[model samples]
Target chain A: MSASSRRGVDVGALVEQARDGSPRAVARLVSMVEDASPALREVAATLAPHTGHAYVVGLTGSPGVGKSTSTNALVGAVRARGLRVGVLAVDPSSPFSGGALLGDRVRMQEHATDAGVFIRSMASRGHLGGLSWGTPQAIRVLDGAGCDVILVETVGVGQAEIEIASLADTTIVLLAPGMGDGIQAAKAGILEIADVFVVNKADRDGAQSTVRDLQGMLGLGGRYADDAHWRPPIVKTVAARNEGVDDVLAAIDAHRAWLEKTGGLRSRRRERAAREVEAIAVAALRARIGDLRGGVALDSLADQILDGKLDPYAAADALLAETSD
Target chain B: MSASSRRGVDVGALVEQARDGSPRAVARLVSMVEDASPALREVAATLAPHTGHAYVVGLTGSPGVGKSTSTNALVGAVRARGLRVGVLAVDPSSPFSGGALLGDRVRMQEHATDAGVFIRSMASRGHLGGLSWGTPQAIRVLDGAGCDVILVETVGVGQAEIEIASLADTTIVLLAPGMGDGIQAAKAGILEIADVFVVNKADRDGAQSTVRDLQGMLGLGGRYADDAHWRPPIVKTVAARNEGVDDVLAAIDAHRAWLEKTGGLRSRRRERAAREVEAIAVAALRARIGDLRGGVALDSLADQILDGKLDPYAAADALLAETSD
Candidate 1:
């Protein structure tokens, strides 16, 4: 017990190292979280006091919408201000996709040698809710490591991305010209979640109309029914050339200011924490149910349902009762 | 006690009508399941005895892969064989997609007036796991409605589609020429779950190369290392023209035969039922956790985590204990 070999590390020392800006310690902590290691409990306990400082900004859009490029540019801009940054590229795990999008990582090569910037790509191990269950924990690791800002980039087309949006202090929804993204954005309900909108590849055709279309849709959304509301601002950039990235930074800072001024930061963080706690609780319960599979309980219930002797809801009730026992 | 008004539905009568071929009744049952109405327990019970007769085939691909058109063509082919068909368009619900893909439904208009066909569109309603929690219940509804074959169509790019694939007896993964879908398919991990592959838009220039790319990948996958292994066969079709659809149907039939001969059908259905039951149980548990939000227990735990007094896992453990109590 005194040795605590299961964790295989001095968690207190690791947390101290992270707080003092050791990128290796930060990466190791994040890997522990990402892998859902048993050591996570101790790590999180150690990390608690060191968190609550980093601002999490989420960037998401369609696959070809320059999200990675924009994120790269944002990292450069953030680093220019002498602030440390962390990037978590949360790729929705495909049972077959096998790994993270390597192409997207290539764009971040510019920051590979910068100790002040930490970049990690995570793929869901097909855990209960894909990456959602583990993502918040990873963010906490970066926060504990003293990143001034953390950027979470994910493809914005699924429920997981929506969950990521709720976890963010500010969310940037990127669109590019000629992707039919304006209509697609509206169709995908991306508009409602955006704290900031970026039209990347601004040099491309129809960039202006893309912006106008977003403006038209926003006008129709009634998102700003009063002065207290924050209407998402749209910025255009050719992210490949690092054009207009500072404007993106400005938009983020402005949103952050609004969040702080309105007490939105505290409330949003509280909501994020609530959801994170709920997700963990649910995942743990799910694992208990999975444990039932080793016994005959779940199989028996499934057989009953298949045999038409019981309804699923009743079977589920019985299973839950067994779980409680 | 004799009248259960909460359901606003006579579960027994509804199930009876659904079994007797009333599309309206089937639609109502599906709606109950989709809406997660209080009556669902009774509905599932009543429908349980009447299901296990439908062969569920899942169709999935990226948005532009002509999934709806292919589904429409297959419906025609099946209808021509004089078998009743059910189509469940399980659209992954976007918070703001507003509704199902209306354009996809337009292609199915050819079967709208046919009594032998039943089609319904569903969005996730943002339930615990999105559409997944409700989908199997809805499929049971269709099976009880006397459909001989059920086609579940979904966009194949996300975790939800992967879940849909697991529910299927025979899963058909669709692709089109010029979409760079070969690489996308590999990247998305669509290759692993498919029992059948359809290369639509065969007249397009890149179609043959697409087929070759798929064959090459499949060979590299070592999916058929033994005689007992089932290799997914690729079928090319001009679905809009109703060309080569029969071959697609042939591939489906062959797979179905193989599944039945090897007792794979029973095991697959059992797995599907297990997952369905698990999803429902988890959703119930999640909802219970949500219910805690109405009290101070969850919020208090969340506050402690935010204040760095407790880690999320410990909070989750406390929350679970409270739930059990």
Candidate 2:
């Protein structure tokens, strides 16, 4: 297809195909949404009525913590429960090559041919946060595609990964043992968002000690109000060996149950929807600003500041003055 | 001082004291400015004439990766060269306590009584990018204080830490050996910005392998047309023992020399200043929007979105209607 034609994808036909269980259509729709095409937004207006079904589980961690392996194992476990699964592995685009390596696909080879499973990788494309603006919209596409569960594996680049906490209903923070003070650092921003902590690579020597240290750091609970129905649980797992995957699945089920009973799940979904809309609005504003010769003016102001002809404050004032109120 | 009184500091007196080589004045100025008060910005305007002498170096890494130790050792190294040093360590506010722990003070105790070195710690205070909006103004305070070099130590929370890269002349990304997979993950966002890479904890078993991996991943010896005059070098260090710090200083000096020769440093500094101004302007707009009850309308629109009474697109359109030209 021509690039313009691809960009101007027929949203209704794609949605129909996705609803009728065409994986190619689902992938195309995901691409369209992730690109934040205006056409895709129109499609989302139609698909929004069909969403709110899939139980989204976000998987995130410091890179090399085996999140993909854990996600693969979780997919298997969820499949064993007779539910369809959709996986969205968010990775950074190579600055040299705009294409994502789709590293998660290699690890998730087992699900490649499984009709009940769908896997897609989203690239950052140097977006402000690690997630693209269209991520929530893409998630809705997966939701409308009849997937019982959707797993979002985040780019484990720290604070940006925390945005996933706001996006997912259940967020699992994966960690490996013996990372030499990494656990303490991880606790700085990501710890609070974790609905479940999976100490992956449990076969490693310091796995038990890592768990003990984390439990000690967490300090006997009640940090958050107890009224939420479920407390975050730390589960030990050897993802490569497929051990403890069942426990992780059980923990997810328990959290989902609590979310349903306490109405927290609905509230979280509502917040996510709100955030998605705000993000889209902000992105549109940025793009509009860019097209209004803002980039050229910004560069010239930057040069003037460098030349000492203009101080930053005055330059900012001038830029703001140019913006129509 | 009462917190508000502390906020209402005398910038002129502080600038005069700083010019006369008073560390206390510099410290108070940084403290006043780091709070991001309008008063601080006013102070900055008065001090702007006396600023632009100090070379700013931003040091960042994941928390517990020994950024403080490295920064302390760096201060020592810079002082040995007879240049006065100023350190600003940015720490995230404790969610539970709402007070900063000021951990850099504990780590850099050797310089506590030094008349030549001024150290201050800043709290992130929920700033989105791990930097308060007033940080550049604080740097101006230190600059006007006659410090030869100012080192900014970031909160080390990954993505938020990237903000430091924009503000500093030379940015160093610290990693430790045996953080294998974590290194790959960090490479996804941060490794590209490293003007210098220090492999801390080089005493570990996989230190050499880690260095080799980094060298391979970075593809050294490949010449690019846009290459900065000084190529970033990977240095090994054991921060606790203060090993290889001199080499880091030498690398920084070399980078500085190259920056000056190529006029890259001046341009980079100007770019940073321009960016700071733009950020402030954006923040002002956002604050104004909030003050006008724009957020209330947005929130109500969000509620309508959750109730399915209004679609996100329409809600966004409605929210921007007043602002749209």
Candidate 3:
């Protein structure tokens, strides 16, 4: 109940420290969220009252869209407004580079001395596939810690990047000129996810063409959108030069204001919470089932499949029956 | 049981017709698989003995890399060898296009009159996010239907596309010139999934550079490959003209040879089967839990979270406890 040893800091003390804007305490809480620690339930209980104050923004696009640069730029802009900011970069470390990407995102280091900014990267270290499971919970930690806004940046590649869209109140899909066919952008479902589209590296040739292509694709209705009735505005930016970053921020602010005015913000947040609840529940059940799989029952059911005795759905029913209680 | 009518198409009858190389019957069986019909388990049992006969190849790339053209070329090559082939193009119909891309994949129509080649497209319709649940089971139906080779082509976008890499005996990752930053290839986890790399539209400027860039990146060992120590071969193809198509096929053949020679094929297939089995099981349990959610129990638990009485993980545990039986 009191501030004790650093190693065994209790949930209440850690929450207090995090709420007081201690970066170390904030990092520790997020780490706990990532690990799905036993203390997570207690931590959630403590942070409950303080949650939902922070606005969440998800920035995603094809890798090389300068998502990190834009995210860094946005953090700087937000911090300038005197609002505390948290940035979660999912898998910022490239396994192919042996983590050399750590040095490439120099703009992040430029703000290392700014206590007003908190930046963290959720790398896919040992995660073989899918986004990290702890992301939603970690966002909660940031929100509950009293940040004014949290920016989640993912290298808009892979299937998991879509998670960012569902979790964020506003989603910014970034693109770069000459980066590939505009059709690929539509194929990736980016058209459906963009609340705001940023054509980064606007100085590059074909930037206007890219914007036109995106707009043309958006005009089509086969795609999904958070607001089917609201048209997404495309903003051009030279993110590397920190040019037009403020306009992107302004678009976000405008969208947020509209959402609140229309009461869409509250509903979106509720849906987000519902999704989080469902995902957590399913993951837990999967773990329990995984534990059962270590025994002979699952194998036996699978053996029945090999023997052509039972169908997969029926066999799954049997497995669930055995493990449910 | 006899196939008296469409409604009464027995699993046994469909399997028999499909095994006899009837494309109509094969398509029907796949549809059942996709629908997750109650007969799925029964169908799996029926197909189990005849399955594993076809060599499965997965071709994936960011959309607009001429995947369909390349696939059409592969089918022609395989048919030239007098072997029957199956092609599954995942998301060939864009949700935004209302399946207009189905018409756009005109190269597929070139093989329309070829009895030895069967081509079908799976659209992304209402799949929440991630790969559709039914893809693997559909593959089983094709394999059991006596196709000598089956090609699974997915627009290299979204989380589900990774499923193609996992399911295929050999995975060919396609890329084109000017498709964005070369470094993004590494970050997207694409580098790790490719068994063979194909730089399509090889006549375009930067085609060679893309190849050089890919080779340079692959030179980096921070990747996971089917053969941990084996290097992936790169092939260049002007697929639109059908030039170098044979060379690309040669690379596939070469990779297949290496896999078979090293017993990598057997292990890869086993892993594929394991994943398929796990996915079906998980999907079934997800369905069961989804049904439970239709009742009040889940809502009450959610209410507890809103009231600050329970954490998500704890509530999930309680939900599992009540439903395990």
Candidate 4:
């Protein structure tokens, strides 16, 4: 290991502890990586070889839509089916405190002490698209440690939250009644990415109407053929009362089975692997360019461009020319 | 012009006609670009030199949320101040019909014959985000044609719609009462980018409460001293009655003044220019790479990686080596 890696912390040892089933060690590792400690890359390289086991499920929706309650109920349902489940609830980072509430952890206390369950709450930390750089790495650690199902709950909506859909095998979009305007507004982003739609708080007055409206809209712009068989399904749940959780689980199972039957799961996994490689490569290239000798030239160029002394195209050309030499 | 540019319709001539105040020519130019015609890129290049004249304003919210009504009223307010206006109402493309309702055009018919007012509808055409690739170029055409203010209404609430915020000098996010769930869900993306917030249909039951909730949320976030002068102002509007339209316009003016006074506008413009250059460079690189002599070999490697026959990292390395040689 390099000096920076050594002096930072022994993340590999913590990974080993986590693999051997130490919750505290896993928690510590997650925190270290989320904070982008220098040792994260080392830990990630160590853990990469053991990943690809878990079926990651992403749940997203507007706030106050019962995402937490639904997640907790889903965990209970999954446990009853004899599956080892792990939950990663991403919370909004407090811009002031730079900390997260981890409220989902508190809300799901029923499974907190269960040896079969592991729960972690992550803060967004100003990461664009609501994902920290360490999220995929943390998921790898959990997957390597033998979690069968990993549930990821986003802190917010739109493109950032939708990114979870790209990372997860199955993505569920939660909605509530009286969100007609919001749903219409979000049609361009969240609605496009949903693998399944769940209308939570189904006991509300406009529950049936909301479902009908969504169904009508889906019909008008459906991307899948009725015969395609893995089309996104709509489910209704009153998560607070734990109603309709089984139906949601059944829908997930059906989707998984379809993925396997159609040989889509393998293809999806391959796509994900390729994407991960590309993301990492791009990030590494940017970092290396930042660390080059005379790299401060780029910063100075930015200042010049900001001050209108240089056009952006001319500055980019100059930067590229300098790098080429 | 190249053979490919000549064989197709001359986009520059069309643009010149549009600039000479021909509404039919402007409409046709938008259509040609939106359809991704072969000569679109060349046309965009020609139009680029004429951009940076108009102040682009983006208004976005959920469908069925009175966005059209608000936009129509805002156009009147802007024109009443003796400024020529152009409105681009972007709608989601239907997966089945490959068409859009163009509903906003009909709703804003009051200005159809005003000569100074131009309105057009754009379809999303499967672009993942809300804004289409041709939007900026279309805005440039309108700018060169002497529109004092260009208003872009996004297709939906997705992150693509939020892209308009980055492109426009000012962005207004419209929310209605009972959209608390949507607000909570989309807060992470929309709130961060909003220059002005509008709680439309404020006569609704939950309007006051929702505004209060938003205020509380904004308070909990850290305050930047630089933003103090241009803090996003929330205004209530009843578009049907034309109430609060003046306040919204005044708020936009105030924000623009603050942006200029604080030097935020110049810095933001610089960042945008840089990003645009980066986007163009990346696109050019992708196109050039596809036309290289060893392009087939690179493509085959990419296929192998996608099929999982070879690891993505190894394939990337091989491609990079081949290209360098």
- Compared with the true structure, the alpha-carbon lDDT of candidate 4 equals 0.69
lDDT of 2: 0.73
DockQ of each: 0.41, 0.18, 0.19, 0.09
For candidate 1 chain B, which ten residues in a row score worst on lDDT?
B1-10
- lDDT by residue for model 2 (A1-325), tens: 6334576666777788898778999988887765656676576676766777898999888767898888899999999989999988776543322243355667788998898899988765456445636667778888888899999987567554777888788999888999853455355566677888889998999999888877765665445436644557889999999999999988988888888888888878877776666666555555544553446777787666555466556666666655533
The single-chain TM-score for chain B of candidate 3 is: 0.84
Better of 2 and 3 by TM-score: 3
What is candidate 1's lDDT per residue for B1-325, written digit by digit as tens? Answer: 2243553668888888888889899988888876678788888877888788999999999988888999999999999999999998877856533366576567789998899999888776564576568778888899888999999998775786678777899999999999999998898788888899999999999999999999999999888723368999999999999999999999999998888888888888887887788888887878788799888888788778778888898888888777765
What's the lDDT for residue B288 in model 1? 84
Q: Candidate 4: which stretches are off by over 4 Å?
A: A1-325, B32-40, B62-65, B92-101, B125-128, B132-134, B155-163, B175-194, B197-227, B231-238, B241-247, B277-325
Model 4 chain B weakest lDDT span, ten residues long: B279-288
lDDT scores in order: 0.85, 0.73, 0.75, 0.69
Residues A1-325, candidate 4: write the lDDT tens digits.
7554459666667778878878887777777657666565666555655566689888988778888899999999999989888888776544322243346657988998988788887765553224634466567668766688999887555455667877778888888999773465356476667778898999998988888877776676756633354567889999989899999988888788877777767666655554444444434433434554234665665566445355444554555444334
lDDT of 3 by residue, A159-267 (tens): 6567778889999988899987487777887777788999999999999999988877877654443543556888999987889989999899888987887777776
What candidate 3 gets wrong by more than 4 Å, as runs, is: A1-31, A42-277, A288-325, B1-9, B36-41, B62-64, B96-101, B125-129, B158-161, B175-189, B201-228, B236-243, B303-311
Model 3: DockQ score:
0.19
| Per-residue accuracy of model 4 over B110-161 as CA lDDT, tens digit each | 8888888988877655532334345665676688677899998874456655
**TM-score for all predictions?**
0.67, 0.58, 0.59, 0.54
Ranking by lDDT: 1, 3, 2, 4
Interface RMSDs of all predictions? 2.3, 4.4, 3.6, 6.3
DockQ score for candidate 1: 0.41
Pairs of residues clashing in candidate 1:
A96-B189
lDDT of 2 by residue, B132-181 (tens): 36667677678777789999887566554677888889988887877663
